[model samples]
Target: MAGAAATGGSARSDTYASARNWLLLPSWAVLCIFVLAPVAMMLVYSFLTKEFRGGVIWEFTLAAYDQFFFDRGLFGDEPARIDWTYILIFWRSIWQAGLATFLALLIGFPTAYFIATRPAQTRTVWVFLITIPYWVNLLIRTVSMKFLLRDQGPLNDFLLATGLIDDPVRIINTNAAVQIGLFYSYLPFMVLPIYASVERYNFALSEAAADLYASKWTTLRRIVIPSVRPGIIAGCILVFVPSLGAFLAPDLLGGAKNFMIGSLIEEQFKGNAGNWPFGAAASMILLTLVLVILMFLARQQARADREATS
Candidate 1:
């Protein structure tokens, strides 16, 4: 009887362990299938050849990567030349992304700080308002900006009625328009992260700094900013990387004048310039640049975290 009871208990324990393990299997399988598999495919495709036709060739080739770094000679010579266009597009994307990130930070940081310091009930309302636009599709929101910014759009019409200008200024298809689009698209990304960080901010530190005769600016710089640095960093990453690959906003708002790297890649893939290899190489290059930036940000974040913990 004693032996039978012990055996029954061991069986139950084994069954429970098996059930628990089985329950976790689906989640792990889904992650491997959806995320890890696609990344692996992209890595493999980056090295393959794009045939003259629409499909990719299985034959391994370094030519695509070679073109990414060094441009082929105009006559297709032995020594590959440098492609300045790639570099130019890269720099332009970075510049635009950097500007958008900076503006978003300037605006979002204070707004988030305000929301975080508010009472709990008010904070909920503020957060809801901040994120309301996100419920809409990104493309829809971007297109809606056009109706307001076009030559005879409401904004221009209002300005003309007020005698703000002699004629409607060409605001829609310029770098200024691009900046506006970028700021609009990336504002939420900036705000959310900053809000998360600022909510975790130590209220007592600010009070202590104030008691030490620190000015408002000094208190913010010394106490508040440092405490919420993670949020600011997170906001920058959220805004900057995506802004670099921004396509529709620049295409519709800024027109063809300010074509970013993303636009170029799209052209290569879909437009008359049907060079899939080139497009893939360009994409890989863009991914590499983003990874480098992400690494730097990660290192910085780690250092900041260490300092904070220490």
Candidate 2:
């Protein structure tokens, strides 16, 4: 009887496992179809030779990647030399993204803290107000921003009328303008994450620190920040990653004077350049870079989880 019962239990377990696998099939299929397939297609295309205008040829070569690293001058027969041009573009993107992330953190932390500290009933209103500006389409908002920041726009005109400056500040077509756009665009990303962390924070701990004679700054630095660090890191990652690939803000605000990585890839495909494989290669490189950042974040998260449980 015991043996028969054990066999029945094992059979039931097998049936359950089979049913679970069948249920998961659709999700896995969608993931492969939507995400993995495109990546695989890009990887394959990055190796193929580019056709004259827009398509790829079946011939396999490392020319796409080689072009990225080595400068082959106008006719493609120049001696291989380290290409600083693309490298500079990448560096500029990184710098702009980093600056944007820093600005977001500086502003977002204070804004999130203020909202988190508000009466619970009113906190929702504050959040709603913050989100109102973002609900508009990004393109429209960016265009509006461009108009507002233009030399003769309301901002400079108001300043000039107030006798703050002799001339209009040239903001509309500068790197500073791009930085401002990135910061404004992604500020909500930074704020939301930090607000979540701050909302769940223990007020009693802060009160206790104060009772122990800790100054506000000291308490914040030692206790509050350490507690909410995960949120800060998450916010930075959210802002920085998107900023790295942002084309619209750079194109509109920076006047397309400089090419961010996104713009460069875009030009390759849509502009007269029309180098499909090179565009695919650039995309793959960007994907690899983002994956590296995600992997590092995952590792740090795992380590933190282990520490918390331990």
Candidate 3:
């Protein structure tokens, strides 16, 4: 009787395990098919050669990556010279993204603090207002900004009419316009995370600090900032990553004059420069970079967690 009971229990456990595996099969299938398959294809393509006219040649070669790192002189026969154009673009993208992240933090922290400090009922209202911009399509918002910033647009006209300047200022199709577009588009991303952190914060600690004769600035720097560091890190990552690969803002606001990595990738795929393999190489490089950053952040967070527990 004891042996029979154990056998029955083991059979039931096996059945349950099988059922769970079956339930999870579809999600695993979708991930493999949709996500892993494309990435695998891109990785394969990155090693191949680019065709003269378009697309890729299946012959595996590192020429695509070589092109990025080395210039084969003017005639493609001399010793390879280092190409700095793509490197410059990469650095510029990093700089612009970093600047945008910093600006977003500067603006988002105060906005989030204000919302978090509001009465409970009104806090929801403020958060809703912050999210309202997302209801509109991003492309539409960026295009609208272009209309407003154009030399003869309402903004310039208003300024000119008010004698702010002698003539219409060139706001559109400039780096400043691109930065403005990026800031406007990603500000909510920055604010929402910080708001989530601030909302959960202990106001009593701040009060206690004040009671202990801590100045507002001292309290903010020593207490509030440290408490919300996670949210700040999250917001910075969210803003910087997307801004690094931003396409529409640079294309529409900055134009051809201010080409970025996103634009370069687009050009490889769709524009006159149809070198799919090269594009894939660039994409893989970007993906690797992002993955490295995420891993570093994950390690740091894990260390922080261990330290806190200890």
Candidate 2 has its poorest 10 consecutive residues by lDDT at: 301-310
For candidate 2, write residues 1-310 as lDDT tens digits: 9999999999999999999999999999999999999999999999999988789899999999999888878898988899988878888998999999999999999999999999999999989888888779988998998998999999999999999999999999899999989998999999998998899889898999999999999999988887777788889899999999998889889986767988888778895568988989988988888889889987876675565346
lDDT of 1: 0.86
Backbone collision tally, model 1: 1
lDDT of 3: 0.89
TM-score of 2: 0.95
Query: What TM-score, over all chains together, does every model reach?
Result: 0.87, 0.95, 0.92
Output the better candidate (1/3) by lDDT.
3
Which pairs of residues have clashing backbones in candidate 3?
none
Best by lDDT: 2
User: If the candidates were sorted by their lDDT against the true structure, best first, what order would they fall in?
Assistant: 2, 3, 1
> Please, what are the lDDT tens digits per residue for candidate 1 over residues 1-310?
9999999999999999999999999998999999778666766766778876544788788777777678777766757677777788779889999999999999999999989989999999999999998898888988999888999999999999999897998889898888899999989899999999889878889889999999999999988888888888999999999999998788888898898888877876784546676677778788888999999999989887887778
The sequence of per-residue lDDT tens digits that candidate 3 reaches over residues 1-310 is 9999999999999999999999999999999999999999999999998987778888999988998888998778989989998878877887888888899999999999999999999999999999999999999999999998999999999999999899889989888988998999899999999999899889998999999999999999988887777777888889989999998999999988888888888889895568998889888888887788878877766664464345
**Residue 174 lDDT (model 2):** 95
